[model samples]
Target: MTFAAITGWGAAMPPNVLSNADLSTFLDTNDEWITSRTGMKERRISHVGATEMATLAAKRALACAGVDAKDVDLIVFGSCSPDEQVPNSASGVQVAIGATRAASMDLNTACTSFLYSLSTANAMIRTGVVRTAIVIGVEHISPYMDWGNRNVAVLFGDGCAAVVVQATDKEEGLLGEQLGCVADARHTLRVRGMGSGYTNSGVMLGDTEWDFDGQEIFKRAVQGMVQASQAVMQKCGVTPDDIDLVVPHQANLRIIEAVVQRAGLPMDKVMLTVQRYGNMSAATVPVALNDALVEGRVKPGALILMPAFGAGLTMCSHLVRWGDRVTPIATIPDEMPASKLSALDLVNKIRDRKSQSHEASHDGLQGARLIGAK
Candidate 1:
């Protein structure tokens, strides 16, 4: 039977680190408070667009596979922060990497994007549609971030990661997965002033407002992830003891701990990036996956578990069997362009632009103070 194997992985993380101290400059939050609540110390702020990060990650992933971009059959860019809605972000990576013959498309289920993209590519490859594919999970959340909203402002960071999947007869790659969404709770986490609904509504494009019901989101996220993890494991006929490593979404340290406890998985077996990168929305899981391999946690023929929740209240879990290789065949030397501004400066600049763009809502957009009240 044909299966899709993960052959290579790469991550493109930004250089500028936004510390909790930097957030304290404008809000009431400090390192101790933020860390205790979310298990986050710092997160990256990108100077470049999402596609630029995506392109660099794609190049590294292709090089790691020892497969030239020209030979790639598909490029699946999973992200919510597209550079432009018309051209599509996947096409940007395709052009940048010169994947001349590859079919490219974008996929977004928010935080579950990478896993969903992996499942999509795996199905296509297994069905004999595409042979080699690059799947990416990336986000540039800083631009539209409501920097004054302490609730969410401290939880997100900018990052990108990609993995190469190819056809194999081996019993590796994704064995089973569970995907679902809670439409009823979707309203609990909505971003105002982003889509066509806010196009001409006295609100500028980047002047976003957030409706983040942390309490409700916490309950739903924990429940959804735990249930999905259990369902996927049951479907694959594997117990929590059979999972070698768990690479879960980095939303909150508390949420992760809860899911691990409820799913009967030990904390030591899970890979976490929330303490450093915060919740990068779609970038969390893939970045954590790459980090796990780098840390020598993944072994040949090992079973891996990945569970994630996203903005749509979308939830999913994937079970994968690792192949023999964990290290990359070749590591690309290319890096994302360096940033001139510090993390705080970059964030303040965004706030400056946002305030100037919408003077009427300037005070309201200061952070959660204004938006949360709305």
Candidate 2:
């Protein structure tokens, strides 16, 4: 039987850091309050576009696997914040990496995008549709974020990561996963004014306001992640103790802890990047996975569990079986240029731009007139 094996992994984090202290400059909250509540100390801000970070991550992943772009058969770019809405971001990465003969597409399921894209590529490889594929989990959320809103403003960052999965008979890639969504609860979390439904109403493209119910999101997120994690573990016939490491989405510290406790896992067994990177949405799981391997937390022939929840109230749990190799076969020197400003300054600039034009935009951005949606 054919199976998919993850042969390579790489991540790209921006040079700028946005600390909780920086957030205190404008908002009423301070470092102690933010840290005590969310377990998040800092996040990142990008000086470039989403496509650029994804391209760098793809190059590093391709090099790590010792695979050439021309040999790749598929590329799955998983992100909600792509550089362009029409052309598809996966195609941009394909061209950037010179994957001339590869088929490319984008997938967006909120924070679960990376894992879902991984499932897509794995299924295709197993069915003989594609041999080698690149799966990316990237988010450039700073641009669309409502920085003035303290509720959701402190919970996100910008980052990217990619993995190379290839056909194998070893059964060492994604063994099982439980995918689902809480559609009835979807209205609890939403970013207004992005889709054509609003842009068609004469609103600016990136102008956005968030609707976040902290209590509802927290309740639903923990329930979804815990159930999905337990279900996948049972499907794979593995218990919590069998999991070598749990690399979960870094949306909120409380959410992660709640999921782990309910799923019967230990805190020490989880790989955390929340305190440093906050929530990069779809980029969360892959970046945490990449960090695990880099920190030597991932071992040869290890069992890893990845659980995540995103907007649309989408949720999932992916169980991965590691292969014999943990080190990169090759490396790339590719990197993003250093940012010229601090995270706070960059955020301030965004706030300033929105303050100037968002009110005028908001008057028109309220209704749904998207071309394809009702």
How much does each candidate deviate from the true structure in C-alpha RMSD? 5.5, 4.9
The positional error of residue 74 in candidate 2, measured at the CA in angstroms, is 0.8
**Global lDDT scores for all candidate models:** 0.89, 0.89
Model 1 CA lDDT for position 329: 93
- Per-residue lDDT of 115-234 in model 2, one digit per residue for the tens? 999999999999999999999999989988988899999889999999999999997999999999999999998888778778567566666898999889899999999999999999
Clashes in model 2: which pairs?
197-370
Model 1: per-residue Cα lDDT at residue 67: 89
Q: For residues 51-95, could you state the per-residue lDDT of candidate 1 as single tens digits?
A: 888888888888878989998999998988777676778888888
Candidate 1 has a TM-score of 0.95
